[model samples]
Target: MNTNGLKVLLIDDTVMILQRLQSLLAEVKQVSRTESATSAEEALVLMDGYQPDVMVLDINMPGMGGIEMLRKLNVKQMIKPVVIMLTNNTFAGYRDECMRLGADYFLDKSRDFLMIPSIVEKVQERNVLQF
Candidate 1:
C-alpha cells in the first residue's frame, strides 16, 4: 500500500452521496483512488478484489446497515481499513456505537460532510508516519 496516498471505498445507498464523496475526495492529493458501493453487501464483495486503505460508510442502508457490516468485517478478519462512519443520524447513541464497533472516526453527514477530505489527508499522514 502507498503511504502517500489512500485508496478510499465509499459505501452508501444513495448515489448522490457516493458521487459527492467521490468528487470531494478527488480534490484531495492524498487520495489516490476512490470506489463506491451502493450497499454494504456490494462493498463486502468489492473488498475481495480491491483492498482500500480507508472506508467512508453510511450507518443507514437497505438490507445490511453499516453497523452490521462492521460486525461482518470483524468476523472476516480481513484488512482492518480505517473506517469512517458518516451519517445524517448524529445521535449520541449512534456515535458511541460506531466508535465501539471500531470505527476510527465518526462524522455527522450534514455538518461534517466537507471534512472528509481533510480527515482522509490526516489519515494518510498517520500512515506515512507509521511506515
Candidate 2:
C-alpha cells in the first residue's frame, strides 16, 4: 500500500540524527514533506502552520520531551497525528509510557534504523484517509 505523499514531522535534539533521519525519510517517495525540529517549542510552532500525517519524535530533550509535546498537542484535539517514538533509551518503562501516551510505534536510535519503514507502512495502513 502506498502512503501517497504523507506529510511527516521529525523532532530530535541531536543535529546529526535529525539530518540523517530527514534524509532517510526523503528517500521514500510517499513522504512528500519532511520537517525537522531540534526542540519541542520549535516543533509545536511548525505544527501550527502545517498539519502532518505522522510524527517521529525523540522521547528525551532539554525543555519539553516527546511525551510532553504529544500530551500538549493532543489536548488541542485538532489533528490526531500518529506518533512514532524515537529514543536512545530502550527501558521497559519508557516504552510503556510512550505507548500509554499514544505513540503508534517506538524506535531505538542506538540501533540501526530498520523498523522505520515498517512503522510508517503500518501507520499508513491504519490511518491514511486517502488509502
For TM-score, the strongest prediction is 1
Summarize candidate 1's per-residue lDDT along 28-89 as a digit string, tens digits. Answer: 88888889999999999998788889999999999999999998888885569999999999
lDDT of each: 0.91, 0.81
Question: How far is each candidate from the true structure, as Cα RMSD in Å?
Answer: 2.0, 2.7
Give the Cα error of residue 7 in candidate 2, in Å.
0.5
Residue pairs clashing in model 1 are none
lDDT value, residue 129 of candidate 1: 88
Clash totals, every prediction: 0, 0
**Model 2 compared with the native: what TM-score?**
0.87
Error of 1 at 58 (Å): 0.3
Off by over 4 Å in 2: 1-4, 125-131
TM-score on alpha carbons, each prediction:
0.94, 0.87
Q: Judged by lDDT, which candidate is best?
A: 1
